[model samples]
Target: EKWAATRAKYPPTTLALQHFDAAYGIQLGHLWPSVRAALLCERKYGALVNNFSDDDVLSDLQDQGCRDFISDTDLEVHLEQISAVGVEGESSDLSTKTSDISHQQLSPLQISRNIKCLVFPRGDITRFKPAKPDKFGLLGYYLMDAASVLPCLALDVQEGHNVLDLCAAPGGKTLTLLQTQCLGFLCVNDSSISRTLRLKRVLHSYTPKPFLSGDNLRITSFDGTKWGEIERDTFDRVLVDVPCTTDRHSLVEDDNNIFSRSRTGERRRLPQLQLELLLAGIEATHPGGEILYSTCTLSQTQNQSVVEQAIHLAQENHSIHLQVVDLKPLTHMFRKTFHFAPNLHLGEMVIPHLAANFGPIYMCKLKRLT
Candidate 1:
């Protein structure tokens, strides 16, 4: 009644976001009230800083919630004002042709460390320089995906560790691993031929030539789940970023229609494949080595349940050496920004939020005890 009366009395543009609040209330349904409360108190924007120097300065900036290091002269201090509007009908001014949107010298706040990310006022970073070619390639300032970086943190790459990214595509986490640690060898593999090309482009665009051509690095196209059969207990550390239902994109819609899964049985298939890929990663990890299982979905069946099932199967097969690695140590960094699933003995979840809408990313770190 309040929303209709307000809308009828005045145009949506004239109202001070009460319409937006109501719209979200309708869309969020059961979750609206809590989300509204969170938003009412939440900071405007958040993002992680990328590729910075001077630890002291970074620390100071992080204290202020600054995330990005744009350039030496133009350190993005803060975002002053931002605006956007939805398009209902075609207008000549609104060209369909896509062009890059850039925001220079805007400050972002640091949210947490594991990957040294900052939070920002806006949820979507469409204007962020994602496609721009930097001179330093991987060494230069780059915005890493928060969800992608988390698994790399769970992997905890160290100097001279042999690593395998079993389903690496678009190479965000692969680049993070290379950037964070010195590695003996890094094998990045993806099953899809098309995605492998994109992965190569991302890597080639970001990475220095030496790292690209070095004997230590290898990029291949293959079925990731067959690694155990090909080379058992091979890598010191492995990252299995298996494909799963990308819930965020699918769960919500512009018309306020939500949770429209066309085929319910489809959900079970991905989890099965995820488990297979995870098991493959485990089998290919050296004794005493670590493996991180990750997916960009909130589904318990895909995330925690998959981890649980894998662990159970391993244990049933007399695999005491395979054990869950607790991630309690790094909880402080992400706790404020993300919701950790309760009683999460084997895995962690990065719940989606209105402030820093990154994920719905679930990760489980496992180690081979033997």
Candidate 2:
């Protein structure tokens, strides 16, 4: 009852409507009657619009010739704005047209099976039940979505391009990069040896190849902070998915008992480590290559602040520059809490409310321009 009252009292404002119209070159008053009606109702009647059913309000607008609603362009712009506002990440103007890499030589059954496992899988009923399910993955486990994984997978990883996955164990993002089948030689390192072995087990589930079967893929047990000892500019693409406070997960479960003090510590410790890992990843990345830094937390300190710090470090020591990628179209729900630094551009933080399946995850794609 308390939750319901809180919700009812603080409904989301529709500020995006104005921004949407402005972005798409649509006249707010004339585009859709329903939208216009809602606007006028909110302006004149104020509290009355809250009582009206969404269907009724929309139907009334439709009847009034508000047919030309915002287009996909507007939707994309609105989504970008929200994500930009929520997290300090910049959205790229990169085209969505992906290249066809599907191999025709593989049998149809094999292809179908691979696609099924890659895209969708039906498991036993028992798999659906969690043994120790928290909103976020516990300890070395992390549940991530395509928004965080896709950009890493799409990078052009040519032959002989060294790659690194710092803090990679129970590796989902690491697996995505491997699936691209482009790394010259891959290094999958994690601080936990047991988790690294678990990652090996997960990799075994996929089809075996020279990369998987041979020593081409190196699995190391080491701290990510020490990864800077590796030769500078050695990797083509480096992934830094750091550990964070997991505050967003707090909303889904009653973990007050276990997380109370630890959560506070995480808020402080995560930003420091995040910035360190990014510096290590940037140093490890080949000049003109890309580094993707991600975290499964929502704090601006861990997300925006770390990226800004890395950019500053790069400017001071190396000639590296950071380019931001926009992530608005994919994350539509949480636009309110996004924050950014005035000087630094690129990277984003996903808020808890925006994610449908996972807790908040922040991602930043940066190209090393030296």
TM-score of each: 0.67, 0.56
lDDT of 2 by residue, 1-370 (tens): 6555543231222222332345323421343343323223311100011111122332333343222111112445544544345454323332111111111111112211211011111111111111121223222122234234433432435556778888888877666566445457888888888899999875654324455755678888888877778657888878888877543333233344113443446545767878888898898887777787887654556777788888888778777775543433322322221221122234544322211222345677677877
The CA lDDT at 132 in model 1 is 35
CA lDDT, every model vs. true structure = 0.59, 0.49
Model 1 clash tally? Answer: 21
Candidate 1: residue 207 Cα off by (Å): 0.5
Candidate with best TM-score: 1
Error of 1 at 51 (Å): 4.6
Query: Model 1 segments beyond 4 Å from truth?
Result: 1-65, 68-115, 121-131, 136-144, 252-266, 317-320
lDDT of 1 by residue, 3-108 (tens): 5553335332223235435544564466655544443332233233334322243454455545531121122211111111112111322122111111110111
Worst window of 10 by summed lDDT in candidate 2: 42-51
Worst 10 residues of 1 by lDDT: 100-109
